[model samples]
Target chain A: QQPVQSPQAVILREGEDAVINCSSSKALYSVHWYRQKHGEAPVFLMILLKGGEQKGHDKISASFNEKKQQSSLYLTASQLSYSGTYFCIEGGSNYKLTFGKGTLLTVNP
Target chain B: EPEVTQTPSHQVTQMGQEVILRCVPISNHLYFYWYRQILGQKVEFLVSFYNNEISEKSEIFDDQFSVERPDGSNFTLKIRSTKLEDSAMYFCASNLDREPRAFFGQGTRLTVV
Candidate 1:
């Protein structure tokens, strides 16, 4: 089954912070994060392979908790460019991936 | 930065017809994948290929859907008989290896009428 992402949509003023979460019923092997603008393909962000793995890129960061079967993406000092739908994809063995519905983040200036 | 490239940014085809979506993955990348997103829906995985063969495929990939790496540079997905529901943005992706942080192409918007 596909993972589940919370807060289907979020609106934030520029420079504000926001958090999007993803969870699954089964333990995930690896999790990948991506941001996609409308009418475009998903842009690869980062991947968390091991439990408790955390990664950051610019002001965006993500963490995975093995016990919770969950992952969280943190956007700090958000920028207008960060306005897009975020998807957390669960990667299984042999590179299989299942994507969540997505979390739409709108950052307004 | 080399990136995955897909051709025919947009394609409109009639139902019951055949369509082929093409992609050129980043040079030196060994893994290739195909994914699709219905308008306003989640991106769904269709198939993954490695070593010139399909490594894994989702249930969404049925007999009608086929993938082929016809040459060293071109990977293609063929739909034998398109359906109205096949209309979606199909994305081609590639990665180096098992540690799959795949780079995606611009995508082909397939509109089956």
Candidate 2:
């Protein structure tokens, strides 16, 4: 089953902060985050493997909680480049991924 | 940085015609996958191929759809008979190893009329 993402859409200003949450009904082995720009392919942001582990690069970061089967993506000091749809996919056995409903984020300058 | 490359960035096909989308995943990546996205819709999983064989496929990847790793670097998705609903953006992705992180190609915009 696909994971569920909160706040279907978000509007933010440059230099603002935003958080997109993803919740899964089943246990999650790995959570992969991607961002898709208009008419482009989804770009890989990061992947979190285990619970309680936090990973970040630049102003973007994410946390995974296996116990809750949830993950959250944090975009700090947002940039115009951050305007896109975010998808949190749950990776299951055999490397298969189930995609979540994306959270559309628009960052205006 | 090595990236996945897809051919024919945009393809237009008539219904009932066969269409093939080609991709070259990053060399040395151990896994390959195909995904589809309709206009304004969430991406959907199509299939995954590993070790020169299909490791998994989603319900969306039915009899009409087939995948092939014809050579060492080329991965292809073929729709035997196209339909209007099959029109979408097709993306090819690759993973280095056990890590679930994937690198996606620019994508092929398929337009079936």
Candidate 3:
């Protein structure tokens, strides 16, 4: 099943912070984070597995909670470049990914 | 860095016509996937391929849809009969293993008219 992402859209000023949440009804084997700019492909950001290890990319980070079937992506000191649609994909047992509707993040100058 | 590559940045096909979208996954990647996104919508998974066969496919991948790894490096998705609803940006992705972190291509914009 597709994961549900909260805060359908968010607006932040440069140097501000934001948090996006993704939750699924079914059990998740892994959670993948990707960002897509207008007219561009979704770019892989990070992947969180069931073990609950937190991963980071520069000012962005994510954590996976197997018990809650949820994952959260944290963006700190957001930059203008961070403006895009962020999606959290729930990986199935067969390695197929069901992606969420995505959260539109807009970082202002 | 290694990245998946898809052919024909954009394709325009007539209804009822057959179209084949090609992709070249990262050389070392073992798992391949096909996903499509309609205008202003979420990316939907169509199918996944491994070991030269389809490992999984979604309901969206129906009788008119098929996938193949024609050679060592090329992966393709064929639509037997294109429909207006099939117009979307199709992305090809690959991962080194089953864990995660898939690299996606630029995507092919398929417009069925």
Clashing pairs in 3: none
User: Where in model 3 is the C-alpha error above 4 Å?
Assistant: A66-68
Per-residue lDDT of B63 in model 1: 99
lDDT (tens digit, per residue) of candidate 3 on B12-87: 9999999999999999888999999998999999999988888888899999999999789999999998999999
List model 1 lDDT by residue over A1-109, tens digit each: 8889999999999999999999999889889999999999898899998888888979999999967489999999999999999999998777767899999999999
DockQ of each: 0.79, 0.76, 0.78
> Would you list the clashing residue pairs of candidate 1?
none
Best model per DockQ: 1
Model 1 scores a C-alpha lDDT of 0.92
TM-score of 1: 0.95
Ranking by DockQ: 1, 3, 2
For model 2, the DockQ equals 0.76
Per-residue lDDT of candidate 1, residues B54-110 (tens digit): 999989899999999998999999998999999999999988875567888999999
Using TM-score as the measure, which candidate wins? 2
Candidate 1 chain A worst ten-residue window by lDDT: A90-99
- In model 3, the Cα lDDT at residue B106 comes to 100
How large is the interface RMSD of candidate 2? 1.1
